[model samples]
Target chain A: MNGNESVAYNLDTEEPGAEELRAGFTALRDRLRQPAGEFVRAKEFLIEKALLVCGMVSILAIALIFVFLFKEGLVALQNASVTDFIYNTSIQYEYDPVADETVAVGESTAYNWQPVGEEPKLSILPLLWGSLSIAFLAAVFSTLIGVAIGIYLSEIARPKIRETVKPALELLVGIPTVVVGFFMLAVIALPLKSFTNWLGLGTIYVDSYNAFIGALGVSLVIIPVIASLVDDALKAVPADLRAASLALGSTRWQMIRRVVLPAGVSGVFAAVVLGFGRALGETMIVLMCAGNAPQMEWNPFLSVRTMTSTIAAEMGAAQQDGIHVQALFLVGALLVTITFTLNVIVEVIVNHYRKKIRL
Target chain B: MSAASRKSLQAVREAVQKGDRAPLWAAIFENIVRGFTIAVVLMLVFILGTIVWEGVPQISWDFLTKAPTDGMREGGIFPAIFGTIFVVLFMILLALPLGIFGAVYMVEYVRNGPMARVIRAAVNNLAGVPSIVFGLFGLGFFILFIGRNLDYYAFGTPRDNAEAQLIEEQLEPLRAQYREEAIAQAKIDELKGKERGDFIRGYVAERMPAQNRKVFGQGAMFWAAATLAILVLPVIIVSTEEALRAVPASMREAAYGLGASKWQVISTVVLPQARSGIMTGAILAVARGAGELAPILFVGVTFFMPSLPLTEPVNFGPLVIQVVNPFQEFMHLNYHIYTMATQHPDPVGTRSIQFGTTLVLIVITFMMNIGAIVLRRRYARS
Candidate 1:
């Protein structure tokens, strides 16, 4: 036993006279009545109570958010049929003489929402297409640039350069998305439009310069995100693997390509997925640059809406029981589920890599 | 083609004496990519430069101080300046304590349990919800619930027509002549209600109708604050929790050994050490707050709330109001530039203005971010 334990043990083992034992027994009885363990246990219980309360408060906050959303969402869901809601391709019109009801006489499924009857053609397809197209484009761009930069920072760049660049990229995380959107819409989009016009590109002329502009903007915003994440993953590759590869006479680039990059592949994959989730859910940039079109189209040049843009644009006027309102909530739920799944998948992938590497 | 063959070939080449200079192709490729990275950085800088060049010339003391008038086609954003400040300050007040308290509870009190984990996960997800969703909730709950009472229920609607204006202009002198009579009528009404105080008696005669105009629109400042608070709460809570978690377990144990209570340990040992972290989170939250625009739309966020004396009825029909009013007019430096570039009535003014605003916004965001990072880094080291 350690020194302190031995002393305590020796003290316990010693015997004494009956009078001494009686006094010692009385002292022991008093000590047992007010055990140190009881104090520690009580403290632990209070801490547990505090933790429970903290957990409950957060739960309460989220519950309130869900309650508010579902209460309104259920009302909207009531009148909507499964087919009419997602597939009917148009709002229906009805008139009932018995009840003297004249329903909204919408025709040809003008998939537009001009609540004040200002813009008659309100289609969500275009906006959704735009959001997805831009987000996908941004993901592609960020992944390419980020992976390359991450590799450069982790393996290629000198220590000084990496030191400067790493913090610079991480700083991008703190920038507000709105500022990025504003920069793209005002500075980049206009110039690109002018340049494309000057180049006499009919596609650029016909399609959305704004959508492409927004994609580029969002890519810049998240480049740091992807780069930092990928860098972390790249760094996680064991140094011994690099040393062994070098001893085998492989060049730096060759060792990185064959050993380090391959070893860190899961992390890189996880980073891309994480970045994609972020890109999909970004609201402000798409809202500003998507031109708020809601029709479905495959063309990248056309102005389109995303689910997020639809929520931002329409949530203000959507009546609690209206189809438009329910659709927005549904879109939100869909997005949450998508991102949540992505996050879980990423966590599993990262954990698997960590276990495999054991570092 | 094969790796073995390639290695043998490399050895043979090295034995033959390779050139000192790197290959031309590799050099060229390196230069090209390096150039590309520089270009990206330059693009951001260029955007910021343009915004400053355009907007700085327009910014002046007079522009900052004078109230907006003449359909906000003229000078100043005094009301907007104050409104933005008040809204941001109020939001900080609301979010700071709650987020810190919640973080403390999570880190200090709770053990690793299933329920705690669930709550933590839920909070993380809630952080991802769009700010506009918060705006929608604010509109339904805050504006309709609270604003309705303050603006519509308590205050009478002011007359809007030219006829009413004519009547007011003509009746003013006559009302002055009949002041005693008006006072007597007010006193009688007050006594009928058995009012005990002079303030209540005077309130009936002096109560003005709600202004038809507002500083921004209707409920802009309050809703803007609420939306911002919601936007920053997650960031604050996450950062603060991380900070609190960083406190050593031994510190708590030591405090307990000294016979300190659980609350006493947290209040004395845990919180003081986490102060820098909490401050850093607060700064970052403010940085986030300044960049938000989506929720500003639903709240009566005008570019400028007209400068009215605080004692006067709040009216939003000023140039400051138009700045944030997306539906009607645009006025904040950002919105103004957006409109100038995209929806401007005139094209010549659009390009310059857009560039200027973009530059200013970039600079502001960059500075704020840098400040936050510095704070975060300092705390991290500690």
Candidate 2:
């Protein structure tokens, strides 16, 4: 660099040496193209690997859940059979006057989850019905109101009102599940009892913590889910399609019904399916508000225990390596399978919708 | 508007003149939607209103700062509040790193791979798994499997007591049966009394459970925090991913052109911009953790504790340090509300206090949620 400066100074009126400039430029390129230090490379490699592991942690956690559940449950099979998890055949003892012996009178198949006493019946049927019935009722109720609210928000409400209402819905969405359960038990029961009285239903007692209240609580929890999803579904309809429909002299309601809703039908159905799965898995609300009698009945007034509530109620008290804990694991496994399947179905529907809409 | 409005106006007028009801029918549909919307809004308001109406009057300075008294029928919820804070702090510390890294992995590396898709799907499904199922996983995996293994390897034979109990219970019957047979054999063959005793002891010892116990294997705040870290993993990942995506790609390209590495670009250019979004994820995770009761039902939540879940002072010769212990059971706000409202001996007397506790929990979660929403909105606008 000193020799180059002397050469430039000596040049005076003559042109500077191009070779020196080229050499300087080459030096800069040499510095520019080198790898970002060995230490940096090692650090980057290690960090990337660590992050990749972190990324897969969710998958690992899920696999561990499945593995632990099955492994823990397999031991209990020593005391309880697979058939015992489905239905139990109890030998009914009766006094037969003619035979003068109790003899093998009858064998009746029954579903029970009694994991204590002499006969540990671990049948999941009663819980299945309870989960399904409550979830179904919630689905029906939430879909009715939720879909309407979705349409109103997406199409009818003014922008300011929409902005206000959406956040309010979010606040509702953020309300803890247990709070909703408590409200259903302590508060909602009052209005419901009044309504029951207005209907003059004296013989039909409205139990405070029945499957009905559970359904109501679960539905309230899911309405925001269904509404937001349905809102997204409706919003996915292109603006041009909406404008094109309106230009054809259709009313806003007509356009929504005939154009937007039909176009977003797949997404809407996906939302409802997702909501049903959520309702099926809802725990605290059903646990707190449902009477949790674990009965199989058609009457909405009867108390019922869901798969989730049963786990929450029983798991803590279950002794380590016990049959009761293992039974709960089986229930957990069944729940994971159902929800996982529902999620897959929704993903498929959403992917199909995306592809169709892209075209 | 000029042509479409005039045409619609004429259509309405013509329909009215022809005594047609189709236009009115359309309006009726809109009105019905509005009705349902209003009804839903009213329902939500009624719920919130009921809580505020009953809870606000009961909340006081003592209620906020003091522990429960008279069997939780009187006094404040300070311990529950304290426990919730420490738990949330630990949960965020555990969740944020993995969540942020996972989001980075999805957004940067593996963006086009099947692995990312699988993880995305798994996380979404796991997010929907019942809160109680998380409790099960917490019990079975964290408390039973990992915690037991960690304790056995780190804290000595944690399973010894449980093994002893199981051996005692099972071996008694087996030992009795063996003794009866051994005694009969001894009477026939004239065997020694020591030999018969040895036979009974060996038979009992052989039936002992071989596997895994108590320290971390039981419900404690540590396992509760770990359980909640997994529970809110999905929320953190999704939000962080969204935040990462919000960072424009041009910045990364420019950084790369200047010879900056992938992580360098991310740490310097991306994370700074995505900080608010990551904060949003943390806030949401906190809200979910503090408000969630079912996930912690089996994971260390207790009805009440004489003291907080804090550690005893540790001597380091010159300085002693005492910190909140994550292994001990703690009284949590949500669990406190649960036990008092339903299981407390005198629910009637504790009504006001229950409402007060509910209000405090609600306020904490609501504040967290609002902060997340605000951060998200701000990020979106930027």
Candidate 3:
């Protein structure tokens, strides 16, 4: 009846009586098949809910991950005081002979992460240092090369060159971190070590699996991420800005440096931050190349362990419900917190830039 | 045509010529940028070239078809290759539909709502979550929680953790015995000036019971595939959403004009138009799944899985048992490379094998990526 009313209203201008009568009868017949309509409605409702749930699954997964991580990690943190857990240099837990439990000791606290010793030290500072130094080096190397490539693609390259090079650069993203790790370990590390030795830099020994090599391996993975992001940002800058700068008697390079780069500065920053997040969380490359020696050192040539590598290398053999396992989970929790915050910041910055450009 | 006007015009021409010359620093900077771009391309070439140079020689027909021998120091990586393919296939099966549906909800059903924003943020954060964390999550949730529960419900008790541990403990003596035998055999081979470690190993292995080899309740192909599905879910959802968004509004409007419902319009017009894009996204996700090693490291991947995932026919007769069990441990190319490069007794000896395995993985992943890219290009042109 409702369908008929709407049909009649529409056909009133064309053929009033006969058309309306036929449509009303048809609509009445359709209404008799109300179960089919209900079936369709039910199917649509099912699909909508299924999709909604599917979309929300990621959030659920992340929340569950955080819950599981904290649940496992908090037990260890309870035993290892949060401040000592965070700031103490050594992961060595001194056993109180009288109390029959591991406790912090010594007048001068040491910074080592020996989670599997007589006195298990769970200091995360060294791991943090290793992770930060590698991530910093990787970010610097990747951003320099990535931003350069982006600039070349957006401002300098010919159309044909751009077409060929852009996808080729994207292909870099598909290379697995495992392969990169293998390459570093197998092909690059030895050669690089020998090369560094050949340079005759006295007292500067390059370990085969050092932070520098790890950074290089990680840089390879993050470069494409940064390049593509920066390219997008650079491309988003208005063509009119470049044209105006060029018309004011500036060279092409000057126009790009002054007008385009400034306009896309926020986007470039977001790209760099995202790249840092990527390098920070990367596991396989660091695990294979970063020589899993947790130490509080900034020397690029020395072996250092990152949070990701530590988790990967130790999680398998670590006893379930042991302090070591819990400590690893705590490291994972720290990683998730840091990377999540970085991603959120990057997203906010990127979104704000997009809005500004749109306005 | 006056002399003074001509002189002034000549000076202006000189000035224009001088202006045409870019500043030296700018030229140097431009070249440096260009060089960096070229360096990126060269890096790709070098990586591929090195792998091919070292790997191609080892990839014979026998290498492709044969199983690994001598503790993976010899023979082919057939099991690793097969396991990678199977896991990637399973990952796609689980991730593709869920990802497409999620994208559809984001693009078609939900507009700029708070729920949509939350979902988007979740996906972004998920993408940033370390691959190693995914490994931990897999071990903790999929294996420890879901797997243990499944075992408890199926077998009517918690999986005998003690029994599994007992089996593992039992293997330690056998491994020590084998190692002693290997050392003794190595001395014999050295005295004889020949190689007999393989024969000695085979002889030692013959005395070990099959029951001693069985392991359960921890690393499994099912859990690995599940973890990988979650890992690549963001990739699939992001690409699928982009594809769905690329579908023109006109198509939906046209369907609506024909009195079609929203669901009908999407099922008929929008889905068909975005089919290629969805395919591309699925392929790309498969490519990523194929290459991912971190998530599977703890979930199920092993250094050496002598048998295939599917158990072979027990009796080689007309009536045979063909069981496709997903709970078994499997070898993967990436994990194989890791173990060979790191855990092998002789890392230098296994260099060729490692390179060969890496090359195979690279080839498989590149093929998938190229397939997706080609499909995208064709569809985009249309």
Candidate 4:
């Protein structure tokens, strides 16, 4: 710019603001500053770093949850042995007068979860049985209905019905579980029990708050979850695949069963797995209605206590640092671990399914 | 293709050629599935109708305005409503920044990489963690660890808040009568002595609590809201991530072309476009977190609290303001319903009131959820 200005001055001794023009151009370049100034760079760097940290909070939260649960749960270990924790209740011990020790032998197969009895039992098997049975039963019922609904939404529904029903189901899912728990406890349990009794099936069904009742309550909560998940999965199948199936002279059912369902099977697995995880960890409904007997029986007709219900029902009453609190925390730890692992599985399956299915 | 699929295809071909039974049978199957969907929808309607029908008549103006009496059977749920609002406000306040920033990082910065994959997996896991596990963490971490440390460091000892308040109240007259005048006179007299120092020292120590009371080390609304923030984080992140993803890449490039920095481009361009999405996610997360009882069950929520959770009204000379005190253990509508159904001495008698509270909670959550969904759909379309 100085050279050009000097040449212009040499050519015509006029317009002597060339030096000012050069300064202005230099100032403009400084203002543009393609490689921005240090403070701006520092601020950008700091914000980027902070955002990355915020984004990583989920992983940090999972770790923290695991740490805190185990830190509290391991308190029980300070009081009892691992064997005692795992094997509890219904052990018949014989005291030999000569031996002086109350030992001999007894089968430790029985699993009792009586955490507050004279001799507190901490076996998780009863709770496990309850959770699995309830989850499985709920899964079986909700899946059949939920999947059918999903298929209908994805394939057979008229546009208007689909539009209305999908949002309704979404709203249904958003209804709090506490409400469902209330409905089960106050509305469903006694009436259903009486109906079963009038039909002479109450004898088998045991009580008002049987496992069947609680499972049905949970099914109500998870049905919408599963339906929405399955609907999304089926909707994710490529449009051309459906069109091709129809073009091949296949019936609509044949198209769904053969083409769309096959394509979305992995997604279905992801949805079912997620649904099972949800049911397994469901707390309020089971806590309210499942009698909480802690019976080791697998019968759906009988009362049982699930791991989640055990935590929800007993955690508040448990002494802050007592063995019961530790045990409850351990149950929570176990529940989270299972659900966490289930999520990992679902993620892997969905990732693979997405990669395969996306055109 | 697999043999089963191949055979199914062949079966489809033969059925189509026959055309006699396939279409009719398919129609019946389709009808059955349609019936299933209708049944599910109808069942939802029936349950919602049951609650609204049973609950609406029970809800009067007094029901919304008054507090429960006669062991929670007689009056309204104003405290629960207030506490629920408090928790949700704090929940969204904490969650929105964490969630939006995190989503911004994913969408605007780490578009795709191993880092993105890990972040996605972490989010999915967090979202899938059981609400009850969140309760355990709220107790173990927030109350036991953070709140305990807060009390230990700030307050010196775990002491009763009422006693402390009582001491302050008692000392008020003493200060007005003696301490302030005495100190002022001492200073005026230019008496620099141990007497004044001891008197002043003694005056302040008198306000220190003498009785046992739990404070931050126990359940409080702040901790419960914090726990709920974590609970709803993934919901916000996932939706915001999608919303950010939807903003066209060309807009970002255009901002850059105009000599904007990355942050400037994002804030001025990307975020404005995604504002509705973020708002929708915020509402949805609040709706999701507020109705949850598990995280708040032991974290802060009380089964019976006679008063609302607001602080004493502050007078700014002419104007006065009162806000919720987040440190207090408060009542929540969901927990109220839980307690009413299960812990009431007379659950049968309290049934109507329980329905009333449940209806309020149901209405709030449903409105938020449906509103978010509607907004998202409308925004996506336009």
Candidate 5:
């Protein structure tokens, strides 16, 4: 309070205000010694490096796949012309004048993908369509069955029954897709063929089985996914909400339909999306059961080939850098694009629902 | 008023009682749908059962230990068993660390930023790619790289093979015009082979004659393992990421609060807790790796070989070679059971073996899955 009194801080000492200087230096040391700062810095650095390396590895793997496909596919692509490839001409009406009954000879087409042509006619449109059709069919059937099972497990069933049934259903997941294919090929395909023939629909082309068998087989694989995800999502809906709904005098079915189902709709959608993705990517069942014929027809009882089947079937013999190989890679790219788009859409929907519906 | 209320309740109960016993039509419909569901489930079980029944009766102790012979009666699955183990072990050796590290980085360290986002996107995309694509990749990338790197051993002189010889013959005329013609011709020849011998020797050295080891068998265990690794990586990464994500945030917070480093938190707290989940994922992955046929058929499954099963204590290769070719009955009890069961040969005699193999495969997968499930449940409860 006097001009003679000088304000002094320990950071700058003339004669050294000993206590103040010691306190300031100690404070500085403590700041440097905070464990939190060191931990954050190290953690951030390691994570950054790890993520970069992982990112590089993933990109490298995916890029390698692309390069290989393109390398092989390019060889196949060069072997055929675009026009012949797309139109896929088959010599159906051959000039057999000697027989007098106009016997048909081999045509430019049989099913959809006849890539093993002398001139190489690669019509993938039918196979793509068949792939989508079969996948869609499987998704629909599985979703319906799975939703019902989900409801029973989460809401309707007794605890004992739920426990018993849940594992049995999940056990289906352990069964290999190839085994499933063989099962359908032997049991479902043959039986369905006979049934169709007996039903006066013998002309329905069930002679060798078809996409329906493949779809059914795929449904078997995906149903478990739907059931599991739907069950989780439904269970995730707080029990209090269900109690509230029932307290409002709603019947069990009414409460489930009005409140629980809506609450878990997004999750159910995710399950279906995942199921669709599975159906789309499934190779073994479709390869075995769909007759491996890429037909563009809407007939479920007709033979069909999918993009996956085509790739699997022809990749073995497709000449290096040939036109056929290129088409196969193109198919891979197409599949990747379709699944990626579907995943994005599902994620968007999921994020949206999570934001919109707090419960 | 109480009487009226009681009467109303009684009326409601009577309606409920009536409703509990569904109308015949409704009952029929319910039964029909349930019947269909049961039928579908039964169909699945029957398929598995049939494969086991058919496949198991044919597998004997001798069949497992002996090398494959002329037909189903003569040979065993010793080679296939060895091949399976060799390929799987090598693949695990290669893929596990890579996939786990990648997953760890993705979940543990990576900030929720663009770089992490890109990595996540790559993983998501990788999971969707077909398994066979990996086979092709393995063929082109791994095989070729290995071959190019080891070309000296692949070719005896590193330049004196049919391809190289042909290239030299073509360049002989060019050598006369230039002083460096002979050297240029040799260089041209070397370029023509393009490490062909190196690649071939790496895979074909075991099978090829030492004097001429130019051509390599396309199918090899390394190729198989690499391809399988690619196929299973996506599954492993996805499951690992999910498992890592499931770890309680408080676990990490507590460790950090105790002045432990981030690595310590992950290694001690996060990893230990997520171990069971990771194991479950790996088990499923191995199951997937074992079941795949399409990729390996082209990449590694041998059509024929005439060497004894590589089962002796000294033969250290990952695959066992069958002294007899496998193509004849490929449907034998142990090896190629899946392939044989469904192939054109549909002989009545081989059905039992098919069933047995199916049973074996199913049992193995089921045991692993059950263990995983039980462990997961215990972890959850704890």
Candidate 6:
């Protein structure tokens, strides 16, 4: 018989070909099993890679934002020198009837931010001053109260009270910045102005919308942020430090002041810096309550325009591709740089202290 | 020598007695700090109390349902309420998946790699970027760039002349009326020459009907929602990461021991356990999104919109509502409050309405936050 027929005959007769058939069947099964294992491995690899890409989106977004802000803002810098734009303070935009245009009238050939004047001034100094003053005020007020609240929550408050009060304080953070601005404007500003008037400080003239009210509103927003951060920082101080101080015959306040505060000093600093970053970037409170008058005055009762307020107020009406729009973008870029640097610094401090504690 | 030793001993005894007398200075300092802490709490209570007291009077069934009348000095803020809800809902939908996926990747896939550190830094920086900056980004990227591109693709390359003509024709009567009013007012005020002309032009331009015009790369609801989604993304990611981290390690180990794949383990074991925390993160995102006004200022918010963002009732069927084109501008509660409080022609006259709008916004945001807090507590317990 031929080889194939002999094998079939052997299989039917239970001869040597039966062993060959069994070996072939076993080889086929192994081939199938190998691919199954490979499929599972392939899937695992694919999913892991996909998730990694997803995780990288935040990085991608940050990069994209930096690129876009610089690209748009650089257009303004090309039109006006950075030194002129940042250093010049005057915002006088005089209309020249002869030329049928608005022109910058001041003798100084420096940039000023008079977006609506015939000659638009793009100076950023007043905006910077306004932002800094209000943010400074907010930071000062919030830090004092926030640290106290943090201490209270971490050390003084009973456990049940802490649980209730901490979340309730956090709820304050959820209140919209606009609502805070509204509260400042409708509920707080009038009374403040009246009170100032009643005190016979009429010359001080707390404009319904002024730096003080703006700072007040902004402080409300920052308090919860600062409090939460400081609380976490204080909590992070090892319990042993407080216990040791207590064991040495110190009261709770003394223990906190001597041991916990020292240990968590870096964290508290980080909290303040982060709060400052928030205040610097805050827009709506300053927009609605800061009064959109770009001025360099430090008086808290006077109306001042912050960088964020200027951007929000003027961006809507600024002509697309015009110097005005580009200038607003430049302001945004400046904000990004400042806030970003502050964030990095705070992060570094926090990380360093955390590592130190771990060690 | 004996007299000097006795005098020193008497002085030490007086010092000890002073220390035993209640530590008055320490007590005073503690009370002062406590007073400041209580003041912070009082400030919150006072703000909420003021809003409720002033706003409760203005909140009525009709006020809640009707559109603003008399230059936004009176009537209900239905459009603003609807727009706020619509924008927040849209934001949550867009942000949740991206945020959850990002958090999962950070927590599950890349545990402690260099890439993870960089991503974390990026997120932290993003969180620090002000809401106003987000608005500018939205205005520049979403509207000027993306919206323009969309318009060019959807409608041909150039402006549609027919649509422009239709809008101008619709604006014709309104413009004429503004001109007449400006002339009459100018006459009474004895205004002269250029001043009168300027007044008429400004009035007509400011009062022109917005919907009649084609969506020519202006602010719109879709862009606003997109901007808000970006604004709250960091919040969602951080909270979601925290939630995922809270899931016990042993749960994952048990699944792995059963030969379950990594994906299976995460989906079945880890995700189920972390679901409530993720939900809490989502709710917080919504709360934050709902309260935000600055991000949408340049992106899409209108001072007043008579109709809802998505649809309006039309006599087409029993439940007849015509779908609002998504590109149209819309009002928002926070923006409405802003305009009423600050930008209204008669800001002093619109006080009740502003308080009412603020109250509604606070209630909505606080409800979401309280819900999230409750969810977190439940999760903590379990």
- Candidate of highest TM-score: 2
Question: What is the fnat of model 3 with respect to the true interface contacts?
Answer: 0.70
TM-score attained by model 3: 0.84
Per-residue lDDT of candidate 2, residues B45-86 (tens digit) = 898787889999998899899888777777889999999888
The estimated TM-scores of all candidates read 0.72, 0.87, 0.84, 0.85, 0.75, 0.83
Best of the two (1, 2) by TM-score: 2
Task: Give me the TM-scores for chain A across all models, comma-separated.
Answer: 0.77, 0.88, 0.85, 0.85, 0.75, 0.84
Cα lDDT tens digits, model 5, A1-359, are 22112323433445657767666766654553465676678876876576557546876788777776666555545665555445666667766778767666766544356666666667767877888988988998888887777766777667876676776776787776667776676556776877787887776556465888889899998887788788888988878989999898766666777899998899899889988987888887888788876667767888878877777667777875456667777676667667768877777876787776674
Q: State the lDDT at A207 in candidate 5.
A: 44
TM-score of chain B of 2: 0.81
Of candidates 4 and 3, the better by DockQ = 4
The DockQ of predicted model 3 stands at 0.49
lDDT of 1 by residue, B130-242 (tens): 55556655654555545544543344322224534765666567545555454556445555344534544355346533234333224555566766776687778888888
RMSD of each: 10.9, 7.2, 9.3, 9.1, 9.9, 10.6
| Model 6: colliding residue pairs | A102-A118, A102-A119, A103-A119, A112-A121, A112-A122, A112-A123, A113-A121, A113-A123
Q: Give candidate 4 misplaced runs (Cα > 4 Å).
A: A1-35, A89-109, B1-19, B158-213, B318-320
- The digit string of per-residue lDDT tens for model 6 on A87-169 reads 55555788999999999876544434577776676779889989999999999999998888888888788898888888878
Fnat of every candidate, listed in order? 0.29, 0.66, 0.70, 0.77, 0.26, 0.72
Per-candidate DockQ values are 0.25, 0.59, 0.49, 0.52, 0.25, 0.44
- Which pairs of residues have clashing backbones in candidate 2? none
Error of 5 at A180 (Å): 1.3
**Can you tell me the DockQ of model 2?**
0.59
- What does candidate 1's lDDT look like per residue over A110-153, in tens digits? 44434334332333344456667878988998888877777777
**Candidate 6 docking band:** acceptable
lDDT tens readout by residue for model 3, B1-382: 9998678556656656787544444566888999999998999999999999999999998788889998777889898888998988888888888898888899998867888888888888888889998998998898877877666556533344675677658688987787677667545555332346566666667765554232344788888998999999899889888888998899899877766667888889998889999999899999999888988889999888668889666766677787756888888999988888988899998899899999999999999888887898898888
Give the TM-score (vs. native) of candidate 2.
0.87
Query: What docking grade does candidate 3 earn?
Result: acceptable
